[model samples]
Target: MLPPLSEKELDRLEDLLITYGNDYSVLNLAELNGFFTALASSPTTVMPEQWLPAVAGGKVPKFKKPAHEEAYTALMLRYASQVAEELGDDVDHFEPLFEESEGEEGSVIIMEEWCFGYMRGTQVAGWAELPPEQDQLLKAISLHGLEDNFELLDQMSEADIQACVPQVTEAARRLYRYHRLQD
Candidate 1:
């Protein structure tokens, strides 16, 4: 079984985000905060070269000194799944309504000047993703600054993960948004 990624092993992910993430990601708070904790200690385990999936064709994209959208999204999906298991099956569906809105952005010009889908209505498609209010379901996460496992943070024992719920949703949504890349 793949070991639960140690705090250190998971850290390489932060570095990867900074090196290959985009502008939107650079502004994220989760990456910055998470990286800080990881740096506090040395890796109890060594990071294998294959730790991360090969950057297809080795054409790695350049990002800022922090994680961006992709990292955020991955974080969320993971949290959602984990939380679902912990909270029981009923909670998973409301964990986060991850959706994709790429070319569809600005498709609805609400006042001809203000749009909705970019971030505002991203959660509305199937529903929205807002943070700070965890009645569950955060689709277009306004909780952007988070990079820990938030889903079960409040309920877990002290030794549990930090649950970056917003990031998890973003990653799930992004996968669908960029599905064409796979084609």
Candidate 2:
């Protein structure tokens, strides 16, 4: 699997998003990664148009310097492409953007953020109604986002969730594949 985003790269993108506006206040490096990854996985090829609003909170900022805009576009594409490549592989290996934290609570929080990002993805992609099968995954993401996985965490121990990380990653790949085959 390709190495995940480095701290420096994440910090740079995070700062750039912050500059855009408060709409991005809820987003972070991992959520951004999740959003772009979801978009890349979709059948649609429209990147900047959809991505700008999603990442920038529905408004693309006019950077004083053109390099900032160019750089952001390039990085976002690069990261999403990375996720697409990894998911496209035949192996059953996939990693979520969030790293494991110290305790179950930390991991729960990370899943909450990831789910929230994925939920945002469903909206920004304009996928109002997914197929029943794919919609199942979308619904799970929505439920997790709404509940923030706290309920799930309460029901299942962190180790249980941790053990299922591979499953979650695989589900993401399935979501990608499902959309990639859509009309």
Candidate 3:
């Protein structure tokens, strides 16, 4: 198994992505984590060639040096592998990397970016029409991730959104298990 990235390495990767510029549609660390998680949980394997370009917003970045390119690719692949292993080995304990902010009510989990990334992963995987039961699992992620749901989400109180956090997490876990069972 590939070694997991160190905290310092993760920070470095995040910095590298930012340096690449938002104009390129680069994903931040939290979003990347969510993206990887979704890819890892996908019923079908998504090759790097298929998803790497998606990471760079449809165009692969031109690295300044071969070493930089190698390091970046290695880090991303290892991180993705780690996510797959984590979910495959223990779906019940899988935890998403969500950002948190201090709201008036105290700390609030920011699921938007992560969920958006996950939804992107599902798209990259070209998910087929799922059964209603499984579709609900995907909807949990979409409710927070998709801009189309913004109006519906707006109607929810902070507490309501907070309450949905566990549901989202559980939904992801269940989705993973459901796909694994199909294998």
Judging by lDDT against the true structure, name the best candidate.
3
Clashing pairs in 3: none
lDDT minimum window of 10 residues, candidate 1: 109-118
Give all candidate RMSDs, comma-separated.
17.5, 4.1, 1.5
lDDT of each: 0.30, 0.65, 0.86
- Give lDDT tens digits, candidate 1, residues 1-183: 122334653465445555555543321223332222111111122121221212211323443434554663454334323422322333223223222223343322111001111122222122222233322323223333233424534475432221444444443333322321221
Model 2 lDDT per residue over 1-183, tens place: 446567787687777766765745435767766676566666666566766766777677778789998877766666676766766664246666764466635534356566667667766776657778877776555544555656766797656756655555666777877777542
Query: In model 2, what is the error at residue 34, expressed in angstroms?
Result: 1.3
Ranking by lDDT: 3, 2, 1
The most accurate candidate by TM-score is 3
List the candidates' TM-scores in order. Answer: 0.26, 0.73, 0.94
Candidate 3 error regions (>4 Å)? none
